[model samples]
Target: MPSMGCASAIAKIPVSKAGRKNHNRHFGHSEEILTKEEHISAMTIEHEQNTNIDDGEFDQIPQILFEGVSSLKTIGCPGTLIPVTNQTRAVICGADSNNVIAAASLLGRGRCLVFAHSGYPYMFINVDVEDRRFVENCRLWLAKGRNAQFVLIDDTQSLSDVPLDETILVWNGECIKNDTFMQNLHDYLRQGGALVCGATPWGWLQLNSGKILSDLPFFHFCDFIGIKLTENYSNCSNPMPFQLELIQFKNIHHATQKLVADPTDIESLCIVGGACKDLNVDVSGLPIDILKNIAMKAENEVIPSNSCPIQDKCCRQKSNGLCGILCVLTSTKAPGIANFPGDFSHPPVTETHVIFHIESNANEWYCTGYYAVAGIPIQIDVLECMGAMGWSIRIGCHSDHLEVCF
Candidate 1:
């Protein structure tokens, strides 16, 4: 639900042709409840209060939700405000004129050039980001749930004061205006310091479609940090970004009918599609398996696809420790529809969260892994509009790895 927390999470972004324009949409995710009743939707929502709960209420949520993330909640309704930028479609907004959340990014470095969404720091958590203070409960949750640490950098002046080796700067809306500070931060990154621009709702321009296009600025000080914004670019071609198209297998090698040559015949969730449909010979719904990367034999060339393919090519699974598929996404769309040879323990007792970050756009998707005991099926349900900044992921679960390119 975290990934698909937004109503528009699962549905694809509307993509249009030359003259026509497209719009935004929302998708929803549900939980799968296995019970004797046999006839009920999975998403179970038990709202104790109809009224909005304040910071004190956050602790009541289950511990599972904060597995790999920390959260912050604060009291007070000072509200947020910002000053509109001059000669540009930008504005500095927040709880006041000083607490600006958005900025315009000038020509610079790294990924897409545009406004940075200095909004919610982490997409996985739901909270009023205006109250930007790390909650003690959240800190404890991440440490206990994942053995991870969460440190809040309360000051930017400390940037130069501290050493920059493997440092990951999570910039909240606070603008880095001083040229000297920008240069110092940039140099630090060149030396291998990691940088991530947070999200904000400051630069929200009323679009022709009557929709608010919100993005934080990514230029000026952000340039040295490898974040820039492209001018005069305001249109979304693909709306349903997560709709997974099913790419069936076309051809299969006869060897696939038999298990791996090894005596153990280890189970593998092989990445088979295009021409490798033959390898998925488990129509009866038996366990699906593939050779691990280390188990791949020299003869395991490539299985030629039947009906060409999505990107058109032979299909092959790289057995790198593939307890699951490392969906290394290379396209704008993550593989929504995926097939895995189900060989995990019956009735997946553990619910693992797989988070993917889109490089082109700093968007993220939180995929929940569900294994149905009845069919031994593995389903990676991607929640709707969940995204944030960052590359490398901290994965915890019993499945193969998947990478997405968007």
Candidate 2:
């Protein structure tokens, strides 16, 4: 059965005094340490609160095996098939049909099956026809057994109805249902199943809801994929034209590849991808490449960056007089600006002081004042560019002033 590549490591750590001390130190905590049993109990409580499922529900599910053990021959397909016995593992993803199909094909060799669903509830409600059809095809393929296992749980079925065992949950972004599913998912993993989750656009999942589910194993699960979902996606404001540049990342499981997507336009204001656990491998290769391609072919032109002049910097001194300082600065707030100036253009001004100015009408203004300065020598990259830069500068009584400056 395909085992959880990362969870095992978390479990092996001892919970004794030394282990607790190590964990506390590693996590930066000096609070009381819980014993192994205590930790499990806490996790159980947290899981239940998040998933809204009882221990009974999780225990009733059968164990799923992913690696090593093998059984049933085939699902009447060319790919290898293992018996859906108690130990048979399964990956349940809420991805588009293409990903479902591709992931299924790639994971078919494992002693597990892939269960893909059509677009999540949000997409089902808003996507256009072509997009809808694409999702339908995914559902159809799974239902027809073209892939491992295809199941659909729409508004008709309450999340509670879904059984949990050796199951993996994948969503385009994050899930907002509640703790019920999360609890059950935890139980399923404890019972032995790995969850391969990716939050595309990085923190895009959090946009669905302001809540953060980082406390759960979801954050830890991302390690296997090689990326860390950041709390910000502001870097995507001027999403590169699909064809002009394709952002690719490496993956531990697969080689790098282009991400294909509609080229006309992309949601520039959302999180895209972020830091990876493994820099050598790009896990976001497939989806990112696909999305990038789609955006390139898009009819809409790419948006510009919004530069702010609030600069921040960090400096480190090496052995000799040599020192490296990293500096970051957002351009003065401007209306209608989308993209941040490229780092190459605004290379750090060695020993130079950067200044930011802003002017805005009193009634149209958003804030009283905002200013930042950073002095550094290291190369810096403008995180994101939104659009025209503007700021309001209060000059005595005539404070209501608006000026457009980049």
Tell me each candidate's TM-score. 0.23, 0.28
**Taking the tens digit of each residue's C-alpha lDDT, what string does model 2 give over 1-406?**
0111211101110011112211121111123454434543443343334332333332221211112211211111111111111122122211110111112211111111222211232333354553454434433332232322222333212435654332233343233333344444444544433332233322332343322324323333232111233332221111111110121111211211111232111211011211121111122223333433332332222212243332322111010001000000111122222343323346543432233232322223333242221221122222222222221122222233334220
Error of 2 at 302 (Å): 25
lDDT of 1 by residue, 33-116 (tens): 333112111111111211233213322222322233232221121122111111011122222112222222111111111123
lDDT of each: 0.27, 0.25
How high a TM-score does candidate 1 get? 0.23
Worst 10 residues of 1 by lDDT: 242-251
Q: Using lDDT, give the best candidate's number.
A: 1
Residue-level error in angstroms, candidate 2, position 266: 24
**For each candidate, how many residue pairs have backbone atoms clashing (under 3 Å)?**
59, 96
lDDT score, candidate 1, position 268:
22
